[model samples]
Target: MTQSVLDKAFRDVVIANRILANEGVVDAYGHVSVRHPLDPTRYLLSRSRAPELVERGDVIEFDLEGKPIGGDTRPPYLERFIHGAIYEARPEVQAVVHAHAEAVLPFTVSTTPLRPVVHMASFIGARIPVWDIRDSFGDTNLLVVNMAQGRDLARGLGAERVVLMRGHGFAAAARSLPEAIRMSVYLPLNARVLTEAMRLGEVKALSRGEIEAHASMKPDDPAMWRAWEYWAVRAGCGDLLTARP
Candidate 1:
């Protein structure tokens, strides 16, 4: 990629961090990353910093193995393996988000699965798989810090766009940064809506046909841009809207 194209990717990653923070999909704990436009073998993620405060300078390039390139000494997120392993396993994924939104936590632990109940979250499909750390590693702190744990989690994700990590958060993958951000923001909203609908009566999630239709929406669609612009302004990164990929 040219210098301009590479700068745009970093800009989008910074904006994604802030947008997810503003939208409550992520806060101080979560991280987001995008595959390098010039080299798929490398990806960009911010150094250890709160999502809301991430900036272009904080963005670091990492190999698919999750090791920071260029010998950058800044600390990295412990669970960055989540991004690397997924990118390694799924060649189609261009962006990855790992968030611990409270609304999504209940479904991670409970038998009730998180599904797409609203049109915006249709990318999640009818059901989301849950990856329990205990199932593979036997009792330990629930973090995808190593390649082994990350690969197992990726296996659980399989062909799904989203997967809940038991006792933790959910990891979302997408073909673009905007789509990944859209899924991250709407996943919790869908969960919250599903919770309320369940309290009233039997919850009717989107039918298979409905999901298939809505999931066809692409990241570059006008509607997606509208959502991204609205979120960028809300996150105080409106100026960066021009830098979109």
Candidate 2:
């Protein structure tokens, strides 16, 4: 990739981390990543650090095996495998986000399914799938630290845009960085809304037609740009918007 493309990718990754952190989708633990603009075999993720504290310099390039390129000695997140496995399994996905948002955690362990209760979160589809690590690993720390565990999580995600990790968080895959960030932000909001709606009566999620229409939103859509700009500013990364490709 050209310097401009690489710069833009790194900038967006930093902005994404900040946005997610500021929005409460992630705090000190979660991460966001983007596929390399010029090489699908590689992706970029921040070194082990708080999302809100991530900067462009913290971004590191990793191959599909989740090994950092250039022999960078910085500590990487144990769950970096989540991003690599998703990118490896889904070629069309340009970005991935993993977070342990509190609002969405209950749904992961409960029988209640996290469905889209608001129009903005229609991308969540009708029912969100939950992946319990114990099903395969059988009693562990429940982190996707290896490719095998990551692959199992990716398989749980399948063709869906998001998958909940039981007792952990969720992994979101999108066609672009903006969309991935948007999905990660809205997933928790949708869960909170669903939780509230359940107390009133049986929750009525978006219809198939509504989901099909809203989920069709493209990364370049003006509405998506508006949300991105708003969140970037809220995260004190508004200046990064100009650097976006």
As a whole number from 0 to 100, the lDDT of residue 25 in candidate 2 is 91
**Candidate 1: clashing residue pairs, number:** 0
Q: What lDDT does model 1 reach?
A: 0.91
For candidate 2, give the lDDT.
0.92
Per-residue lDDT over 168-211 for candidate 2, one digit per residue giving the tens place of the 0 to 100 score: 99999999988998888888888888889899998788898889
Error of 2 at 79 (Å): 0.7
Models, CA RMSD each: 1.1, 1.1
